[model samples]
Target: MRKQPPTYSPQMTRMAFAASFAFAITAPAHAQSTVTLYGIIDEGVNYTSNVQTSAGHGHNLYSISSGILSGSRWGLRGVEDLGGGMKAVFVLENGFDVTNGKLGQGSLEFGRQAYVGLSTPFGAVMMGRQYDPVVDYVHPLMPSALFSGSIGAHPADLDNLNNANRINNSVKYRSANYGGFSGEGLYSFGGTPGSVGTNQIWSVGFGYSSGPLNLGAGYLVARNPNVSFFGTAVGATAASNNFGSSPVINGYASAQSQRIFGAGATYAIGRATLGAIYSNTQFRHLSGAISPLNPAGVEGTATFNSIEADFQYQFTPALSLGVAYNYTAGNNANDAKYHQGSIGADYAVSKRTDFYLIGVLQHASGIDSTGHAARAALNGLTPSASNQQAAVRIAIRHKF
Candidate 1:
């Protein structure tokens, strides 16, 4: 060495540099971390045969709408490998009105979902604002997800199958799939000083899927429906947020607590799939101040029972048709009944683009939450002035 190290050949030096560069690039790939950006946009024109006008009169209306087949949303999701069959994961999703370019979900950014947690071989545990167990494990089996989107949801989305609300300050756990079965649980804090349970929410759900059959069941309970489910502040007399404002359940907005239980199943046969769902919703400790539907300013309770059946057929790899029927009955505060029918068709333009048309019909009978004759109302639309309502929509959707 003292005699001067033999000069390294230029070729040897170049080879050494290439080897180090390759190692640097290959090492990161082995960790298996990834981040993805994704989104869906749905825009449409809607026609309603009966819609409440500014003067509280029913009138035909035409307007632009967003989120027919699916809510327009954009999100970022990421996972970082932590070794030993574990990973760190996070998701942030935002909902918006495509027509007006305004934020949805109470105008909060990332209002649809925001969570971070660890995923392991055994399960996943996340904490933040997120969908409850019912929405995660059970809602997907409902017609609302399979047929016509929000228009096909249960009356008032009483069972939350439409995911009208997202829990805040929450902790959730999802079990790893065991063969064809999985389970989920969630708890949301009230975040109220001195009252840990005043506005809390809790839910549990289980699901099973094997081949062409799928089944799901879930239960959810929310204390202080106005404050907890609607994201209103404590002591708010009326609902501050518009979540779950459908005429079918609006009168019960002041309920002290709310509970929902639901179950659903779907089976595939050839090119068609058949599904059925049932849900029971209860509103407790209602007062006249909260809803005029209560018995003459007196305290009372309310309940709704709903059932739905649906079918979907794939005419071809790029085209599909669907039909659904729903029945809902309300008791306690007011005796009301609702019947709804929905039909839809979709054609795929590409893997990421599609066109769709949907129609819905509804009829209502008996007393309503306003203490007046019940009015027909389709989900996501204004209540009809009378007992019957009809709606139709044509739309284009794109995903990326």
Candidate 2:
């Protein structure tokens, strides 16, 4: 004998279809993509001794400053799962001055970073304005970035160790971590209709980290640095790339080509850590452009060599102290030497909040890029009329 399967009624069939639809909607909800908002707020007050005054003399200056330890910024980050072990990611960050509520990075929105990319098992490829290789790899091992912040950077930050600038119209590649080693590369387009190489920038870097040791090295090259970095600026007008009138390398802004190479290492032993860094920057085919540092027009090549050593001790789980020394020398258009020292202490109020105090002192000698007597200038502070300058800061930072 044969048996026949039972058939469902119309009402039962409709109910089965509805049940399946409900399950489908609920099943994927757990795996849905996510978006997150985050930000950091850093505020500080500073006092500098021997700031140059309008009367061409040294005077003390007191003011409120922002981003003493870390730049105040907010951003949005998002990720979407695409299945097949792949995902899409994007980030948009904005830098701002906390004191006067002004925009940082030349008053442009999303100035700090803006990029979108796909993350695969192999690596990631992104496109947008972004940090170059030096900043991504080598800068992390430098004391200026790890501990002392902007005040401890190499003279003028000529090596880009502090990430003073970001590349625009860039395509970047970051490799997947391979047994504590990783690498990155970046290329920025000039965006000129007739010229493919003009105003272009390229960089590459590698990093390794295992246990308590970290090492990094990188190289960067930029063509028509001034025209590319600062947008369109006519004769003698300072643009976005110009830090101000006081930095040591301000005169080299008109360089047709700029090159930078740097390497750094950090070792941690127990509660103490030691770090060292070396960098070389070269400005080639300089244009005879008028600038605050080169009123008489700079013609010829220039180079700067910088070295830094630093140490940090974690006295307690919540407290740490750091000290660093920097030496920099320049040649060609300007012959100058700078010696700087910095010390700082940070007390963790919580995992996301901290209070810090830092002090820096610097001295300069020889002839400046302007062909005048070299003046001492602490990073992010005014140049002193004499050859000695000092600054101190107290700040509070919070992250979310």
Candidate 3:
């Protein structure tokens, strides 16, 4: 007993259908997934004093440096919805030499980060090349992380602490925030065939942030890193330590080991955040590593303990200033001690662009002729004899 529907002309029906199709084509998409593209470009000029001189010629070296102000990198990040409060995420980041368009050292591709993982209420677990727990949980409380300067890195970046960098073949697990406290732990497999124990690393760390105070602590270990041989390269090469120059251990010996323990904290005062950190590194079983001096199984051990303090001040809504100091002592074959201080100012030109100026001074005491030199040829700089060295840098950065 339904009433008859109103009739329409064929042309009218076609027009109505066309209108609906146009509205669908032009409507905003609300349920579609999203992918974000982002990157940071940081570059600057560096001036180093006390550079090694070749013979009687006194030459001044001045050059542009990338990652001096900050690490230049580009990355892609995305998340896919899986329903039930669960999701999949991935990050692919690459570090590069802005000055010469080269990949970061030791990272073939996607060197900075390449990981895929799942996130749930229990916490997030990730695999395939990631930052260790020390770097993730401990580095943020250091002056190097506060200031845009290169002097903050420890010698050889020996420990993953201070955010000195990342690792490969890693399986990492991070806990969700719990009452202003959280933690993470990681293990990296050497992945060598028939030699499962070589070149492996493991770490665990925790952090807490509540109100105006933040704190973190961590531990790390690396075993049996490989060292290859290069003929006649007596001093520190642009690639690695000059230990290859020795005849007894022609290349690096197997089973070079490292261990680290570190802790840090930050306190918010007014518009400023004050931060401090301390780290200890122990190198063991460093035998058979061909060094220019220690050619035959030099078994001397090295210990590094460092303390750093820093402050950040918000000058304006768009500008900020930071100052920091770091002192480090090593009880090793060289008995090296270093003092570093830095000051920086950053101005936001826009939401995604910024300009910055930074200055740093470094002084080393107890560096012997056989010890690691101050100018160890980092970031492609030629290796020079260990002498006192200092540097200053300024840069601009953009993120999107």
Candidate 4:
């Protein structure tokens, strides 16, 4: 080696050292670090028996829609094994429309999820934007997660039980399961200067699974629900008019706070599974919310109660059927009521590809937050101009 060194050029010696250094650095990292890209694409043709327009006109609608069964998204997951029963992990998920290549989730990049965390034998801690406990733990037991997808969600998805919305500036903790029992919680910062609790959100969830039975419960509290529960406002109008989408809770935007509590259970028997769920949503101390129902705007309280029942059967290894019914009623404020029903069939062509057909029907009664006659509204679709609305979708989904 010494004789070879004497003959070697400085450039060669430098190259050798650089190669060895790079190898040493990359070898261990290559073995411990990994990154994966995954995504789901769902699209279909839909027929809505009635679709309401801004003019309040109801008309038959035929359109191509995305996410009838599952939301279209692409995500990257990364993991680094830190050794000694520890690891580092992160995820960046983006929601988009396959038809027009437009960003989903209010057009924000990586809006579906963007978080980083550390994992240990005990549990995992994640920070950034993510789903709340209700959407995580209890939602899976809902009919929407099993079959009909968004359309199967309760009227307006008022309780956010079907992942209709997400939390921002959040820190979440997940505990490892112990004998089929586990739990999770999250706290979100307001991020407003000098106002500690102005836009904060907090959620907790507990779950249990044993054999063929599953149970879960969750609770969520939000300050400034006008911005936290509803989407962002359009400019200064946000101060007084922060409501957007469904007429279900639009009039209660001025509520001082928001609270939602829900619990659900599922029992599986061979090829069939039966599920039930209950939820209560409240807007406390509503103030200055201008709407047709509350023209003068009052400081009253509003609440919504929902109950759901569902059944699913795996007819075959690649084919499944599901049906669900949900009843939702509002207390006093708007006195709105809705009955929704859905049935769906799914067939798998391969492990990552599937086709599905789903039909949904909704009937509304009482009064709506818009101060007009109650209208039927389904999740991921526009409201109807009348009391009853129906829709059917044939969709294909692919995962990678």
Candidate 5:
């Protein structure tokens, strides 16, 4: 009788204790969430010699440059759980010029990244201004990782395939990582009313990384990329031709749109990494007046074939050295040829900081136009001004 009385309520007693423990454990997790504020601030001094000014003047100029090592920016990112396997996610990022406190995202404050979406085991779908999949997946695997950008980046970063920039009014999709292989696709709403057919772009890209090998490929086609780089626009006319806000009078006029598709890969062995990339870019539907010296209305199609090889080695955990060689050949519709070569290096001061050095050498042959020298001088700059130029930059970058 005594033993039975003591055991009578054992199940009820255990249930009461379990409820108290669960309440204590879940109270904090339910009452509070986490938000992270992060950003990067990078700036430095840049020196370029033989900076071609006007039609026939080369001047050595020293100035403060923004984003030589990394673009300056600040952003907010957050997450909240909705229970089960679902969650709410959002990010708002703004790019700025550290030297002048100017907004980096065109005229929009949040031009760098502004998006909200749902994330799950299947994948993620996001909307707003965003980075093209090609830049996100492909450029990171190239020598540009150490050089800060691809040598193949087009004039004024007019296109994203080389990771020059991002686009507006876009929706993006990213697949969850599957054993180091993932894919992404993006569609950018041209946002130009009746001009829809002539002012839009679309892209798709993929990446696979396993062990010491990494590979990426992507394709991009724009209806009128040349218009922005070669056309005359307000505000641009006032700035230096190097900036390309307008078309210069007495200057060469070249209207050509482009389509680029290519693949790149990298291999890591021991303390060194080796990288290579091949890109094919074509310019079509060309029409423009050559330099005033010869305004016979120049028109020609151009094809560019570029190949690059790069190497990086860690001298120590904090000290590393990198070198890259890039070679490119341009064949115009008339089969005129232009060739360019480039090399560069970088050093890491810490996980979130670094310094860099780079040089480019270019030579063109078989072009028959007064603009040929101007084109070479421009080094493909939007306004095109260098017959031959060299740049050496030193910068410091910090991330939080």
Candidate 6:
């Protein structure tokens, strides 16, 4: 899940898929250069309870899904040494579904990442489509990422702990590690003519590591979040729909501005690791007609706060187990509350392959972002027909 712009970023890996192949060559004057190829394949069988339908009702669902634990993808990475502790680097990552063999990330080629920049002892600065600072820093420390994956995310991945969105026309900076401390800052241009405030996003994040302790924090703000952060589609509400219809964030789709802040810490003790994370998401100046996002057409600011605690234990060299609990509370649109839990077990067959089993359960209460009764909604899936939802998955992931 971590893409190294300069191949110097910190990563908290726990059975995480990371493998690559490099080809080296001699450039003019013997300037060493290298190009790498990397990819991953993930497929799974899933069964979910109480999936909601258009009639305001629901049904159970069973299907084969791709990229459960991690999105299936491939990419090319190149680096050329320029002498004196400096180098030039570039990456082109593509996301796709193993099942349908279709592009992911809104069907954009190289949608996952496309950037190039110079790397020095200080850091690397790249411009292109890229992930925000939160995804670079704090997300790796979240339970949804380090262990159980997407299903473990707070309701609807409201705080973007699941990388539901990426920034376009962006320049990002990743700092060199100093005394176990590193950081990132990102800025995205709106690219909208005549309106600088229409679609702009900026973020900053930092992390610290010492011994077995890891800590991370990040803050992000987006203007015209619907078009800037969600997706810049043609209609007024079309862009916001890119984030999906989950009540947790739907109503705030038309928010004139959005802000997200998160922090977390993880520590390892013996054969076990434990972590906790907290996030705050706020949408200001909601606007739009009575749609799925704004069923009540309420005009006001909305806020959601979430926290999660997770634990993982290594039972053996090849097998590990994880569990996590998450809570989210919302106000303004409605006083909604979401409680979710996840259980996961993974067995490593080799350095590049693993099998996993995961179970997730969720319960929701109060009014939702849509102004209706809250419903259990897991990240990357349909909302539950009822207030409670349960799901199970068995999958395999291979990296090459």
In angstroms, give how far residue 382 of model 6 lies from its true place: 1.1
Per-residue CA lDDT of model 3 for 1-400, tens digit only, reads: 9999999999999999999998775552343334678888887777765455656222345778777556788888877767786778889988888888988745457877889899888789888767777777777776666674555555444454544346677888999999988999888887669987776778899999999998989998877543211111123232354332211122223337667898999998888888888888766665645554343344556567878788899878889999888776766543666676778888999998888887666566564224333333222233334434455667788887
Best by lDDT: 4
Pairing residues by index, what is the TM-score of model 6?
A: 0.90
> How big is the positional error of residue 366 in model 5, measured in Å on the Cα after superposition?
5.0
Task: Give stretches of model 6 more than 4 Å off.
Answer: 1-29, 232-240, 288-293
Q: Between the candidate structures 4 and 5, which one is better when assessed by lDDT?
A: 4
Better of 3 and 5 by TM-score: 3
lDDT at 302 for candidate 3?
Answer: 58
The regions of model 1 sitting more than 4 angstroms off are 1-30, 232-245, 290-298
TM-score of 4: 0.90
Candidate 2 per-residue lDDT, tens place, 55-85, comes to 9989999999898678899999988888887
The better-scoring model by lDDT among 4 and 6 is 4
All candidates in order of TM-score, best leading = 4, 6, 1, 2, 3, 5
Q: What TM-score would candidate 1 get against the native?
A: 0.90
Tens digits of per-residue lDDT, candidate 4, 244-305, equal 56777767777878899999999999999999999999988876555642454755778899
lDDT against true structure, model 4: 0.86
TM-score of each: 0.90, 0.89, 0.81, 0.90, 0.76, 0.90
Note the Cα lDDT for every prediction shown: 0.85, 0.85, 0.66, 0.86, 0.60, 0.85
C-alpha RMSD (angstroms) for model 2: 6.9
Note each model's CA RMSD in angstroms: 4.8, 6.9, 7.1, 4.0, 9.6, 10.9
CA lDDT, candidate 6, residue 296: 71
With candidate 3 superimposed using the best TM-score fit, by how many Å does residue 225's alpha carbon deviate from the native?
Answer: 3.0
